[model samples]
Target: MKPPLDLDQLQTFITIADTGSFTRAAEEVHRTQSAVSMQMRRLEERIGKPLFEKEGRSNRLTEEGERLLSYARRLLYLNRETLAAFDDQRLEGTIRIGTPDDYADRFLPEIMARFSRSNPRVELTVVCEPTPGLVDQIKRGQLDIALVTHNDARGQSEVVRREPLLWVGSVNHATHEQEVLPMAFGRPTCVWRRAACDVLDGMNREYRILFTSFSATVITAAVLSGLAISVLPECALRPGMRVLGEADGFGPLPDCRIGLMRGQTDQPEIVDALARHIAESLDNISVPALDDATGLGFGAQALGRGRRGTATILPGW
Candidate 1:
């Protein structure tokens, strides 16, 4: 039988895949860039396949690398679970995590469930708020960690996931055809709201903010009620929503980036464990394909799964 894969090398590989840079992964894993490169080379040799390829200034995983990623995550998770099972002193503390309401709706359930399973002794305190407030809580040391929309101007964060920001309207509504487009949007501080306004201004499109709210529920209600249009990321797409493209006179928007912000805390190990769970959970999320008929990217059937009462809206903009 072949030699077992090295867990240390596998961890470094996963970090590089998540961060999209060997250099950054080095920083995360507390190794030099050259050391990280050496570990990856050994990993590739053991697998007998090139794991990464140069893409612009960063590294993109090769097909083999993509295939190995799933196995790597599962192996590491199993290792953690096994260790926790027998360790009487397994981490036990309260972790205060903040996320915007939209993110809480789409992502928190899976994250919380997985983290709780692995670290059952730990208590989780979840706070749902907008990104700005979450950031403030992080700065004030009130929150141990936060999942927020990554904005360089706001502060630094570890970017975890990204998806296309699309214009969406009710499938049954002709809101896009209106001369003065009515739109529902988040507060002015929201990056998505600013992006939508800027894009419309550049296109000289006549539009009015029909509804304004910090709550994703309010904005989603406006869109699904056939009263307004809005911009949202891929994961946020829901059954009644139709994505608007260039054919609909809507310009393309920037990608929505989700990130993690950690505050100064005494419980470093607990915080790191939670962070890993969040990253893994978000990384496993599959982006659905765009539908040709209604432009509802995951289709109505896919959106119908386990999404009974959830509102389709942008997360933590």
Candidate 2:
């Protein structure tokens, strides 16, 4: 019989794969980076296959790595389910979560503020990253839950909020209907890039990648500086930023979903309560009524509908 795999190693491998950095994985798992590396090496040896290809600071899972993903997920899920089934203690433990800097900047603080107030006993850790990183982190059990930009359907997550991605630029930028449009984008792996590129490809629109970075702030800065125009969630647009009238050749991008995800669906009370609270708050948020009198650009529409304190975001803007 094959020697049973160690749960610790499985979890370490998953975390490293999900975070894409040994340093980040070690912090998530509360282990040293060297220790995490050692565990992964042992895991690869035991399985007799290389799980990940190390290139620079980033790591991509090999085919063997992908094959082991489901097993790791199942193992982690079963372990959490079993623990939650038998434990009868009051809800207490740190639940680390990942969120995008854009969402964290504009939306999450208010919701998390409320969550902290209600559950004084539960510790919540929020890691800010781009959407793809957030999704991978959740899948690997690095994050208990995440608020992220929705992309391709991920079997491991549940959508709690869905919102449109909008096109924005500086007011001074020129519009071009005939030439390749310039764009400022997040990293290559970002959902926004995929969404933007897919639409551009479908419409056969010519375009050029003007600028790209992992930092939302950098992208926003580039757009704000008139370096290049960009498409982003409407909520991210700010004063001095201009909303380019929708890309003329493309249909609306799908609403991006953001919500809770864990290796195990069965969650402890604290985690479940936090998820419910976030979902309910998201649903209940009310946008302030728009001013019919003002004929502002597409950017202003978002703020007009956003109530200072309300829930249930409507489509449009």
Predicted structure with the largest lDDT when compared to the true one: 1
**Whole-model Cα lDDT of every candidate shown, in order:** 0.85, 0.65
Please state the error at residue 289 of candidate 2 in Å: 6.0
- Name the runs in model 1 displaced over 4 angstroms: 1-4, 18-42, 45-48, 55-58, 288-294, 298-312
Per-residue alpha-carbon lDDT of model 1 for 94-174, expressed as tens digits? 999999887887888889888988899999999988899899999999999999998999899998887777788988889
Residue 140 C-alpha lDDT in model 2: 75
Residue-level lDDT of model 2, residues 1-317, one tens digit each, is 89899999999987887689889999999999899999999999999999999788799889899779757856765575466556566466778867766666666766686566555557888898766677777777787777765555644467666555656666655543437878877777766677877887887888899887776667767776777767765445455566554544544665545656654434566667677666645654444443333212354454333212322111111
RMSD of each: 4.3, 15.8
Candidate 2: RMSD to truth: 15.8
